[model samples]
Target: MSEQADLKRTPLWDAHRRLGARMVPFGGWDMPVQYATGILAEAKAVRTTAGLFDVSHMGRLEVHGPTAREALESLTPNVIGKLALKKGHYTLFLNERGGVIDDLIVYCQEPNLYKLIVNASNTEKDCAWIQSHLPAGSVLTNRTPDTALLALQGPLAVTIMAAAGAPEASEIRRFERVAVRLFNNPAWAMRTGYTGEDGFEIQCSATSAENLWNALLRVAGPNLVPCGLGARDVLRIEAAYPLYGHEIDDDCNPWEAGLGWVLKKTEGFIGAEALARLKESQARQLVGLTMETRSVARQGATVLAGDRPCGEVVSGTFSPNVNASIALAYVDRDVTDETLTVESGGRRQNAARTPLPFVDLPVARKKKPAGLTSTASL
Candidate 1:
């Protein structure tokens, strides 16, 4: 591991250290992996109540122009033009060979303007790719340095936001974003999160980040548990959300990750032809696994059918909610409904085919209302 002085840090670095968080290096940044209370407690808090996460490490970009939508659509598998104002959806960026570059959330702030929130690890690469493919006259602003992100997640998330002087936040439905005054500071609250729970991702100016976090802690009071990347990872894994460099990467396509729904087949984007070929001639596919024993299957663990190795584990964990070991793995397209095994510590443990998302999501995407609000009060 590199020295702490060599790594980048978010504005909330000091706050995390003060809380006795366990710091670690992630994507060239020094971040908190877990707090003193531990990952299990923090993850369970998000499941039953609410938890706060400093996600400022993630990248943010603002794009706008007459050709912005079309330009973005050309780079991603999702249909950017079809995205409605103030709405956001999960999308994937692909390489020329149809492999996933990164999975991100694209929010339509206006007809021609959009807000892109991408993974921390792929920030630089994703920005460079977008800039290189940007149309003439289109504008791209990297707001990662100027902005700070916080996720207030779980069933009690809305209540916490409403109590924190952002009553408008409670009104924000799934996949919607609204700009409002949080702790009297300008902030954007998106009704989206990676925890598979009903929550909001709030973005505020870097200058007001600590104040906003402190204010939210006070407002949320005893209901708020400060979570770290460790808990965040476990939660997303339980939700079956793909993480870059893990479940999906530059060498893997959406089809292999069970994310074919994000692909717009008719709309020709970058790598569309490659994806079309994969669709016609399917190969390996991502699937869920439930271990029959207590042994947890780790990443890169070989999955087997009897004596034959068939797949490899992408992400696996001992699920707190499920009270069992679960995993996501990629196996041959022909393999289905067969008993499988995973090798851990030279011992082959029994596993069975299970559905994606070991646990069901508490929140579902809401339908867009007929009359959309044009102006967001900030």
Candidate 2:
């Protein structure tokens, strides 16, 4: 079969094409890399205003049955039992060696039930791995086929969402999910996003995707830009959010990846023993790098401390928000030099150690009601 025919199309694929998006192959799916407004414009819209993203290419899996909680806790490092109803948490699925299988967000919908949003490329592999570890009375179901996800991100995201039909989205605390009417259709809205901005990741039926997309655009008018993967990548890179293949993989552990914060305590989970054995001295830690110029470093770029190669860049780009080049790299723990050099495509750019986030964005888009506590506060 032709490669194009083999690539999966999202429910809103036609909508994206109609908006003059540049289609590209990503994770075995035909996705848009950028719209005609270009990556910079789309990213600016997201940072300064709002942008809507059709993220249907991601995988959604449902874990049901009585043993769901027990089975899930065994596969990840986070304590799954602590998730309250309608609440979710970001976590990593780990192997016995403490390597990350994937990083995902798990939401508790009911007793013994969970909805996991995994990376698009790792859907099948993650499913198989989870199934192998699941004990009796636990069940796993792939819900990607019937689900469509829309991420409306930026500082103005909540305002735009309320104007688009989901006023209750403003009240949804970070990490909390609620049922809402979006574009006059029933859907679930989660106050979670990857861009380090206030936003909502709305889950709706695949059948309603196109109509909802159109309605959101019409209601948002000129305020909301339809962003593509290019802008999405830039936004996430600026936020220092890890991508599956670049910043994280099966061989990368939480300690080395700067993901130790996800674990409340490391004793009861699958990789607990392995994680407990990890020490700071033995870890190759992830760090943020700010380049002196606009010279962007690509993944696999060698990071040098003086003349010696000490690490490799995992993700990098020219951050529009910062108006300069930035990157994330895994540097050897023994290297204490504040000044480093990143060599990419044979070009060496001087860099300095920067904090994790290149841009400081809001964690909570809107204030919660008096009784609700934000996940950001935790």
Candidate 3:
């Protein structure tokens, strides 16, 4: 009772209960892990048609000042000074020792204002760290408490937007955000999502969240299903997107973790010097693995190359999209064996080294002309 009482609930908490969502504690919040449709079904819906997610638990912050650009440039590895208005890029914040503080998206909302969305678990830490680094005149405001974020993800998401009273949302390019209307209410809509699907993440006031959520569902009708965190986790994992504490963390190396792309210019950010110094010593490569058996390998499970312990699993789950249990792990860069085994629960399961993104992203899949069909039964 005390634990439940201590957990915070999002604006749509009661709505989730009404939909028969299974509640679980996540990042100090009582969130829905899955709905009545189940995790697999919800995940499949996102990959096929569309799915709606209540991602209000993520932290939203706004920074404003004449020195905002300079302050952000000094803090992240990605180049922030070049971001045009309404454009956002994935970036990272690191400690002086080259350790990741958090991975977040930095958006240029205005000439002097920027919006940041940080991980739910890292929100407080990120706020303190960011606030301390800003210039004297710069100000940081935590908008998470007053914001409600909803993600409409899948192939049908774009079509659903216009019907949901946000026609402008469909025109927003990827990574570009715009102020739009959701069911006639103002919203901040961005063409971004974590599910490796085409979608938009809509941010609105907490007071408008429930109304917006219901309106979108009503407009989409049967095309969109309500998804929960369990499906969200599976989708992100299948896409090989790193979770904060899993693939990338304080002890993890961006270079070895295949996150070198985020380092747009390696020598400018706070951790550049340390990263340059430690690159050679961090000799592990983040790799994807698919289990040969039904056994699921979880984080901290030991990876072995023929009998020698080579690495450990960082994140793993049964991917319904891939039809197998898959995992991401860090292994010795010199280890060349593709066949590996994960030892957990007193047993070893054979797993084969697979490429990242066990499932192909929707954008990469081929399409046919509107009237074309794939070789009819003639």
Q: Candidate 3 on 38-78: residue-level lDDT in tens?
A: 99999999999999999999999998999888889999999
Candidate 1, 164: how far from true, in Å? Answer: 0.3
Q: What is the TM-score of candidate 1?
A: 0.93
Return the candidate ranking by lDDT, descending.
3, 2, 1
What is the alpha-carbon lDDT for the whole of candidate 2? 0.88
User: Candidate order by TM-score, highest to lowest?
Assistant: 3, 2, 1
Model 2, span 328-355: residue lDDT tens: 9998888889999998777888999998
Candidate lDDT scores, in order, read: 0.87, 0.88, 0.90
Which one is best on lDDT?
3
lDDT of 1 by residue, 1-378 (tens): 548688889999999999899999998789999999888889989999899999999989888899988888898888887788899988988988889989999999989899999999899999899999998979999999998999999989988888888877877878899998886778999999999999999999888988888888888877889999989988999999899988899988787788888986445688887877767676788888999986788899999877888889998887878888888988888887568989967888888898777777887545456456435332
Clashing pairs in 2: none
Query: What is the model-wide C-alpha lDDT for candidate 3?
Result: 0.90
Total clashes, candidate 3? Answer: 0
What lDDT does candidate 1 reach at residue 365? 49
Which should have the higher lDDT, number 2 or number 3?
A: 3
Q: Each model's TM-score, in the order given?
A: 0.93, 0.95, 0.95
Model 3 compared with the native: what TM-score? 0.95
Where is model 2 more than 4 Å wrong at Cα?
364-378
